[model samples]
Target chain A: MSVHLLYAFAGAGVFTIGLFGMVFMVHLLRKLLAFNLMGSGTFLVLVGLAQHRNGVDPVPQALVLTGIVVAIAATALALVLIRRYFHLTGQVTLEPGSRDDEGHS
Target chain B: MTSWLLDGLVVFMLLATAVSVLASRSLFRAVVMFIAFGMLMALAWVRLQAPDIALAEAAIGAGLTGVLLLDAVAHFRRGPDKERGGAS
Candidate 1:
């Protein structure tokens, strides 16, 4: 269906943009946010593609529900770790001094 | 009919907000916009006819995530060490 196709395209775009942010951003929290975007995009694609002639599929819906719960828990743990790291090193990024070292080569 | 138009608009808003979240200069602003983006995404789920996902997105994506992001922002603003001139 055209509606399905449109949503799929939008999902793809969201995924691509999230990947860009995850790869380029220095801030760990931004990377986490981008990761969430990527998760939403994936959920969109899953739900979008599961539609059939009769009606919507329930399988993907259940899976995505699980994914959402898992994602939130993972994000919470990551945030705690990041906060601890910040307290220890006062650096938000994982690889601070190594970035320039990698760029030169 | 009009439903198709709504879908188009929802998708448009999702893309727009997603881009803004990535592009915003201030990390705080980006986090705030990301919360907006998450809620808009819940709208997109509604348009997709997945009320369950819409609810989940609103709760987890927007609500919990927003709370966690705001907490992190507070840490970012309140420097760990004022003498070191924390800017990271």
Candidate 2:
């Protein structure tokens, strides 16, 4: 098998593993980490697919670049929310009853 | 020389990184492993002939994401619920 194809397969496998980890892990931080892994895996696949006879496709590379920016923005927002939730409830895990409304009523 | 062998080694490293990322005990360790994974992924991109992706991955995937994760870990560590660090 060509090296490029191998990278594609391995990336897909890691992507799946990371997806499973994100879904099963109870910790929010771990979930976030898993999500990053999945994103990297997707990037790897895109890179592999972009490889061509003379050169790689610039289109997929551009898309992947955009994806990385979006991922970082989303991650920053999520981290802010996690911090706010912790300050409000003093708990890492978000409990349904721990909402701000419960404190007032 | 067998060139395919080196490719196989890269695949093994990628798989190992995936496992470490999922199985790491400490949140910090997991995040670090993820950064390593991104670096390896960039190498894979270069191997695949996508220099643009290699540059993007090195910058945004590894650099920006690493900063974001470190900030998150710090945010969580400073919470009032220090007693419940392992509540997860």
TM-score of 2: 0.81
lDDT for model 2 comes to 0.73
Off by over 4 Å in 1: A52-54, A98-105, B82-88
lDDT of 2 by residue, B41-64 (tens): 777777777777678778876898
Query: Which of the CAPRI classes, incorrect, acceptable, medium or high, describes model 1?
Result: medium
Predicted candidate 1 versus true structure: per-residue lDDT over A19-50, tens digit per residue: 99899987787898889889888988888877
Q: By lDDT, who's the top model here?
A: 1
The per-model lDDT (C-alpha) reads 0.81, 0.73
DockQ of 1: 0.50
lDDT of 1 at A12: 87
Q: Evaluated with DockQ, which candidate comes out highest?
A: 1
Q: List TM-score (chain A only) for every prediction.
A: 0.85, 0.79
**TM-score, per-candidate, Cα-based:** 0.88, 0.81
**lDDT of residue A90 for candidate 2:** 65
